[model samples]
Target: MLETIRGLLEGKPGDAPAVLAPERETLDYASLRDLCDRTVERLNALGIGRGDRVAIVLPNGPEMATAFVAMASAATTAPLNPAYREEEFAFYISDLGARALVVAEGMETPALAVARRHGARVLRLRVPAGAPAGWFELEPEEGGGAPRAARPGPAEAEDVALVLHTSGTTSRPKIVPLLHRNIVASTRHIGEALALSPADRVLNVMPLFHIHGLVAAVASSLAAGGSIFATPGFDAIRFFRWLDESRASWYTAVPTMHQAVLARAARNPEIVERRRLRLIRSSSASLPPQVMRELEATFGCPVIESYGMTEAAHQMTSNPLPPRPRKPGSVGVPAGPLVRIADPSGRFLPAGEEGEVAISGPNVTPGYESHPKANAEAFFEAEGRRWFRTGDQGRFDADGYLTITGRIKEIINRGGEKVSPLEVDNVLMEHPAVRQVVTFALPHPKLGEEVAAAVVLADGAEVNEHELRRFAAERLADFKVPRKFVFVTEIPKGATGKLQRLGLAQRLGLVE
Candidate 1:
């Protein structure tokens, strides 16, 4: 496997466009390589190179995409969500021990103050007005921290290329450092799973700070010598227009974004008719089977749902493209790593049994950084191969199709009767008025926890709680049915647009 970020871009046609954005000129492969070389040289001059952490805070766009590839080639790149508050920024900057903070020129963000307080240098990126998309130069902020001796070159296979914090839904976020080998392996895996080629173009709407966007949307496309149509961020209203403009062959997004696109898609009939998409991908969350069906019907493309997480770099399993059967609810077969079901005692389970999902492969990270306790709990040796427990409860069919029941932690325990939230979600989605639904555990005084659901109704749709409860009763057992139904126009989402289930009960004031 290729072991370096720089290696992912090598051997491609130099003149082919690699990065593009709405109304911006294209950045070709040759120019992109040049940018990486220059960026590495500049970082080396600034006394920051391999082994040093550089925290990046920038809005979603082509520049963020390019900066990631370039900085990873040069040093360890930690891309933070730009929407973080001052306190959040302070925690991440201090936790990462970032040597420098990279932000767009003239862009004011809380990260600036956090970096300054930590005594980390600030590097401003300048994007030339008429330059191609993703083309930029990094300059040291005035009065930046003093320069120290630097290793000064592209990172090696063993060097950490990217560091991302786990979502930390149940515990404090752990730092995950993916080596160059892990990233390259995952990149190639994604490219192969999607059957990508130089002519393939992806209209990426995922945030750059996330593993799904950084690897699946950017690295995979680039590795296949394909182009990325980078957007500022996901805007459902403008998605059709951009799709028409970019003439993109495909796009990848979370289920929430896909739902939003579907909501607005009905209004863009002409664009939908003229656009010819080869495929659509959904990941970073379990795309509800309802959304998957609607997406395939609306766009006239296969909706490929893949399973991923930060520990695995990104992709773990993906449904194969045409010629192979694509199971709607299942996340498809293992596309990148060797996946298996493991019992609580760390024993690998055979097919047709539900247990925790585990994986072992080149793309899997070595372990969580600086946390021996987490490492001990996460990684274990099994069947002569070390596997990382994915914390997801799932099972595989005899045919090798994997079905994710739900997050092990997110499964509802109503008087010890286990209820898979995903199962409840699929049942509720059958209701005509329901556009989206997230089933979670609500605190129950007697049972300890009860099943509850937060639902978003379709446009102009109306359904009383009693009616929905009745609707659920017919499809689910009494224990599996949601006792409380909270209807809202929109469900709260995380920074990267994933529908968060943990802590949702408290956020919705249903924790009593």
Candidate 2:
């Protein structure tokens, strides 16, 4: 069991590949460990050391992956989305009280200006020509304070390793700090769930800024002595080609990416056959049973759907691989933490009863950083243990398989009856013409809120609202069926490619 970031790299064979990218040299474990050591020394010299926050704004690829691992081992790392505007960058840099900002050489982003204005040192990540993927040097810019830090060394197991803000769909984003112990526990859980080993190679397309990508795809793979093929980002058009080149045994992504790959799987039959994946993993959002079934049929591999969030490092529960039954709709049993259903007051709920999902374990964060009110509402002491509420409504079956119905804030209340958008979305997905569907709440004069859906039809497939409503009505209760259907080419997705239901009504112009 890896207890710290340094331990994650030390046990791996020195000569084994740790990171790889398309058409780039591979970074071996020995060099990767050396990078961490050198990176810590450089940061110490620059006055940024353990407990200091370093904001990384770089495009997704080997550099982003490598920087995260090396920097987190040295100091606290906060990776912001490179696509953020100046205002967004300003808010995060200031909110995090970042000591430094890191950007790739020749890269242009608003973070550069934001970092300067916020009094944070700007460091340019320079990748040497013809260098191994993920090898880089950090050069400080001409501004910021002198070289000095209170704590100067590699981070300990209890030191804060990563910090990320909540999506804040309903309110202001809250800071979540994860210790090295939290991440190491999570990576061990993911590695164990997937049965990872040195022979495994992962094709990672999830954005490096997100927890799913950072912990599940990068850290877990490296911790298992496996290598990850990092990509620029998720590009549906270029997925198969990369798969063929990387020869990855498996890959993990959100459901949207899986659907996109399935859409293009037919054109690249040879590549699909040549790279017969060991298994496919989905997380960050619910994986529709419809999409899961299609993915398994196309890839001829088991589709392992997992549940995760930033508050819990990354993975909380996952469908086990092989020999064990993988439930289609359920996120499967607890993989890393003690997952359970709790009532409103925090008491445990019996199996088969719907309630808020709660977890308590080593991977769970201590609490939200510096926000006492939010922390009070987010955590509760129960059964002699502190459990963090997941804000997700779910229930467990007799067999202990957990099925998440919907987000607590995302559930639609029609007059008095509660409706889960996920339930409606699942039924609508059963329609042959529906490629993707996001069920949301549209404000209604009498009902307060009415169920509506945005549907994306499959290629050359057509269906009217009446036909789709009829299909959904057959499976769902009348109140749960979507009353209004809006057909579109593509449903809008969040930065991490998740469909946001909380504000979808306003985003789609359905709210008036």
Candidate 3:
């Protein structure tokens, strides 16, 4: 399992750079391997071993990446966001049964208090000001202490490598433990789909805590012996500069990040001229067809929309890179496993039929950690194989391209008519004044639930409720048009950085 990561640090192109950070220094294959080895020794000296859980509360950057590799070498790694509040940290730490918490020196967040309260060992690493948040120089123990022993040989495929909490927008977060085999299989599949090789370089701006960043961007690059430019965060200015500096061949991010990049495209045409990007990947949230076209036009590259979830490790279906038609709105055909649409009764639906999506693959997780009820409701036997029910509504086109319509739970029930908020959102987003939009259901005494929308206008743009309602009315049915329109500067996003629809109404005071 570690062989993939190890190989990337050993047998890559001699001139290829293994990792490029936003600032500070870059590391070649040899340096990266040495760092991982030393980091593993440091962690082992702290008493972390196989089966132990090390809670890593850090941000994106080289340190977080190094810590992840080091911990996975010796124990289960749980990387959480540093922005989480005290209550959130408490819940996650307890839920994962973390034995130790790694924090940056002088971090004043509630995570530090919670970690101490839980009696979890706290190790402080010193992070330089311009360095990545989660990354810090691990100073050798005082007085030249004895060197720690090396970690054991490669871990078994079935050993749990990572334990992460789901973005619990509607309910309590659940722990999702992914085994080494799951990571290997998913990363290998993603690398193959992208046709990544040692010569390819990726510019990764996504947060490392998310599965998309960990598996799709970082793990896949390592598995394929490719290089990655790890950005501290998504900065449009720095991103374009790095694109040319690192000679990045491809990049991956969420739709929102893509929109930000497109917004800045007109300012940086020189980067495109110098270093042409091969492909742009989008996931985590649905990418609108309009934005996809705009991005492809601006970057002169195809936008590959992929369908994925944390439970499936990461990529399930990705639009083929080239030689294959890139569907505008569809996520494309199943890439590595059996994907089928299932009705509410668990019966498999025929192609081109809208229903809940189900998947059975080697990359899929066995079940949620210690959550028997979730396991019972989420998985079922189909044709002697266990299939995971994804609470998403989608259908396959004649060409086997999967187009996700909406989440089953997010569908708005206006009287007896069901309305897909995503369908309405896409149309509303087409308006020139509409910068960001989210459609949700608000509780109503008469209609049981009414369609409502929250919108963010572009800079210096204005659109009244009446104008917005009229715009949506032209493209949607009466029931589908939002009954209430609320304007806001921005929409709230979860830890994974995806917009949440389940509890938006309550949070915005639109519903009781």
Off by over 4 Å in 2: 143-145
lDDT of 1 by residue, 340-375 (tens): 999988998999999999999999999998999999
Which has the higher TM-score value, candidate number 2 or candidate number 3? Answer: 2
Q: Model 3, range 1-512, lDDT digits (tens) per residue?
A: 44334433555554456677755566666666665666666666665566778888876776777677656766788999888888888998888888778876666668777878887777776766654322345542233344343334434577787887777765678888888778888888898888988878888888888889888888788778887787776787677887877788899999888877887878888887778888999998888888898988888888899989889988889899888999977888898878999997889988878999899998888799888999999999989899999888999988899988898888888999999888988899899898788999899999899999989888789889999899988998888999899999778877656777888998898766
In model 2, the Cα lDDT at residue 401 comes to 91
* Candidate 2 local lDDT, 1-512, one digit each (tens): 25777779877889999999999999999999999899988888889999999999999999999999999878999999999999999999999999999999888899999998888899999998999999999998874556566798888999999999999888999999999999999999999999999999999999999999999999999889999999999999999999999999999999999999999999999999999999999999889999999999999999999999999999999998988999998999999899989998888999999999999999999898889999999999988899999999999999889999999998999999999998888888888999999999999999999999999999999889999889988898899988999998889999999977888888888765
**Candidate 3: misplaced stretches above 4 Å?**
1-15, 126-153
lDDT of each: 0.92, 0.93, 0.80
Clashing pairs in 1: none
